[model samples]
Target: MPHVEWRGGTCRVKWWTGETLPNGRKRYESKGGFTDEDLALQHGMDMEYEVRHGVNITNRDGAMPMPEWLDAWYASLDLAHRSMVNYESVIRVHIKPYFSRHTVSEVSIMDHRAFKRHLADVLPSDNSRQSVLAVFSMAMEDAVNAGLRKTSPVERHRRRGKYKKKKRERKKDMPPGAVETLARNAHAVFGPAGYAFMWTMACTGMRPAELYGLTREYCYPSWPGSDLRADPDEADRYAEDMLRYGKGDGLLPAIRVERQVQYKDGGLQFFPPKYESSRTLVVPPFLAEMLERLLKEHESRWVFPSISGGNLRSANFDHKYWRPIADGAKEDEGPRRPGERLALPEVPAFAGKRLYLIRHGAKAWLDEDGHSRFAVESRMGHEVPGVEGVYSSMTVPMERAIMKSQQERWESLPDRLGDAIWG
Candidate 1:
């Protein structure tokens, strides 16, 4: 029962919260500063109803501040170093300042909605806003689970449709020949390792992080006999070639994508591939040869070490090596424009494209080759949904088919580029 009493021209409602401490102390809560006695009594009754309905309101009156709660929540999480860094950035930059003074109980659905609107107005990209909101929702969910709130205020459903539509409009896949051109140019500017990196990613559908994680030990020249098809003659020839090349007979050429590298804080950190997408992918012979050459020449342990003999950072690589080649520049090749200094020529075909397009190109190539959806998804480190994903495994035929398609692409590259690849 809730009762209101007048004190200093204000009405305060008092109620039993239906809880007791271990020492047998009854727990009660009070809400004060209401001008009307009836209103105060009604407020107290509403809280009592909430508690009766299994909504924990023990801290209703003394809810922890958002910043303090966020810090506690962050400390309790068991996330990877990279993920922890990202979460910290989001909390520091977006969430903390906005919700710092507010108690967990003070934030409502309306407040969340306004925060989202504010994000839309301030953030440059939809992805950024969504990421921040996702972190916020996760924190609020923790709050709800910890009994700090009755429900999460995040309205994910309200934003899903808009996000989906925007995703469709954004770049999905690369145009044909764009990857080959990029690779040739990359080779010219950044050398053989750059070319090998581009080709492997284009063919393997490996994420940038996965590419960075590649090691000499995990990279094989071929698949084992058990995983290969029952073509003894072909296997014999492959074995002979492997023996001649000093590579072991049992190992077939493949890349083991078990981990990924993420640049966090001030250095590179290694983490398991996203969604535990750790699987082996067969590499075409040409790519295997290229990787072999790269490994033999480079003294570093990483298959694709940066120019400074360190872990490859995606941002640094993009800005330094990828952009100049992809976008193009005349670079002191003499002036062409009248009354102008030096001419700046652009690679029209490569301009406005991104390094990530290589991954898209790989997906497109697989789809075009008519590979099984499961095999493609598996190769790309994506989880196939439902029973099909659970039961399905990459079969010999699927592997051979993908390998054959990639082999053809590799064989045709020289003809496609003619003189550009060497120059």
Candidate 2:
């Protein structure tokens, strides 16, 4: 039997049993000295009831604390080391600062809504809001799983604030001349390194990270051994290898995208592609020629190797390479011709001028070259009605048509840019 009682100004608990504990002593606990008789008696009675009923009174508070539970939950995730690190960073940076004081049970929907609104207001970038919310939701899910609360306030917040559904509007892709200008500007401003980089991106339509991870083995000539004529089965073997690496076919011949290069722990490393089928993209004739030249000249295995002979990190590429080219390409809209200026239609000052002229560039090229939405979509790796959007399963005819259209548009690029390519 065990009981609680008043002892002086405090409560005392006492228990008695016939059996001994592990120490081989008689089982008896008592509060011999008690100043508050009532509390002592009540405590004694409660202890007696607990012991008689075989109830556990200790360790009820051992339910994990919110912060401790969050830590444990974070550790359990099998995410990429870099991804896990970033998630923890987001918690420390945004979530912990505000929610640290409250237990998991104390957070309500109102609190979550307020936090969301505050984040929306303070964080100007939409992407930042999404990132912060993801971390917040993960932590709240952990709390719910631990039975700290009825439900996660974060789940409610996310459900309520899901992305709005709208008519699927096609993105305005870069105009026909724009990529060529980008290439020319890259060359004129950045020289050989910039030219090659921009040309590769424009021609392949591979994301920057995809290009950065390219290796010599993935490039043409060597794997197939240069002589497209000498080796009868070279192209087929290349195509087969390309398929194993997730390519639809040998459409992108010059350089294939087997993987991506990502920054982890502040260093460049190879990672799986963003999508499951990150395969080879057939290079156009002009770009393939350019790649062949680069491959022949550069001894490094990386097709688009950084100065460090490793994957080109985003920060380094943007600051050291891309920014300089953008800066050098800074040009003012030259003075409008007198006749053209006078011909321009006038509108009320309050009405903002629309940039309808921009769409015309892409539209004109597509129309002139007999390109359909499918062609444009294919070239830009856009999601089709039945496909995963970016990576197509097999569309040889479609891909070829798209490439031909893009080539025409690219060739029609302004001479200013074309002349900038020294070689």
Candidate 3:
């Protein structure tokens, strides 16, 4: 049995560790801060039970330095080389400098708050600070499990909790004809192919990876083969339209978005679209005609291929074409010198915006037209939520409405730009 004894004013609790030392003595542990004998006795019994059950716990009088614990914890991790390198970088740059000499058991709540304040000064944004804090907290959790400390000292918040939101103006979506403006700039930069690529991405709201991976097999004017099944109620209507589409006389055209090109094992590979959302996106009539022309003009497998006739890597495309098209390029300030090229004016709508914003712009356009939520979400490769999503399905009428609205938006472009596109 564990025991409690009064050594003058304060009482101490003692417990056997259920271990035997090399010298043939029983191993014991003790704590001596309790003033009440009854409390000390209860604590003694609890400690003895825990020790007998082999439950490892904090050593109140012993310590392990944070740096030592972090190194040990990292060494014990079995992770992919890339992931391990990332963790090591965070530990070396953000963690070790602040808590180098502190003990695992002595890192209190105040230290955590102080570290956060330090991070706020050193890190550029809240997200970056949180990411670093998460790495440190993960290490602290391992330390606790290793019995270097009783519990993690790092503060935690509910995943969705926000203490204070940063106040900033919402960015405006690209307006109706802004896509055409980008398409025009692209044409000026890389000729007809660039123009076609920009129009396709803007019109379909396809992710850059998905667009880069687009091949002849999945594009419009040829996809949605005759084998496609329509809702039973609309079977007759679907059959007539599909027959016409196959015969090259129909209005509806679609793209089957299945796979995207991504980097894996240091090489390009095909993976399912984000969230594995294999879908068919309807296209505007103008875009359909444009894609038809472009495909007929090229025999390559990809709908859009780089000069090397392979996948369009983002780094190369962005630097050589996208940036010049979006941000414009020219001499800094003085008069043009010899061998100086003429300037390219920045596309105002996309001057400081990202390429992914085009997807968001497409969504805004669909929503502005008051299309059904199911149809809009389906077109955007998003899964609708709640019972409505579970029970509802995209129908022929929904697709037709989307096509009509998109065609209208395309036709509304000014003749100055419209003439340039067609001519």
Candidates sorted by TM-score, best first: 1, 3, 2
Q: Please give each candidate's TM-score.
A: 0.82, 0.63, 0.70
Question: lDDT: which is higher, 1 or 3?
Answer: 3
Q: Write the per-residue lDDT of candidate 1 for residues 1-423, one digit (tens) a residue.
A: 888899998989887889887899977888789998778988998989987887746765338899989999999998876678889999999999999889998899899988988998889788899899999999999888888877788765555424345653245445446566666555555456666778789889898888887766567542332233334655664464343333455334677666788876667777788877777787776677777777777787778876556666753776666676677656533211223233233445446666677787689889998998899889988889999999998866777688788888766654443234333
Question: Local error of candidate 2 at 348, Å?
Answer: 25
RMSD, one per candidate, in order: 6.7, 10.2, 7.0
Estimate, for each residue in 246-281, the C-alpha lDDT of model 3 and write its tens digit.
315544688778788876567777777877777777
Kindly report which residue stretches of model 3 are placed more than 4 angstroms away from their true locations once superposed.
Answer: 1-46, 49-115, 130-163, 224-251, 331-342, 416-423
The best candidate in terms of TM-score: 1
lDDT ranking, best first = 3, 1, 2
- Candidate number with the higher TM-score (1 or 2): 1
Which residue runs of candidate 1 sit more than 4 Å off their true CA positions? Answer: 18-27, 49-54, 59-62, 156-164, 167-176, 222-251, 332-350, 414-423
The digit string of per-residue lDDT tens for model 2 on 35-72 reads: 66666677677656655775523222224455765677
Which candidate leads in lDDT?
Answer: 3
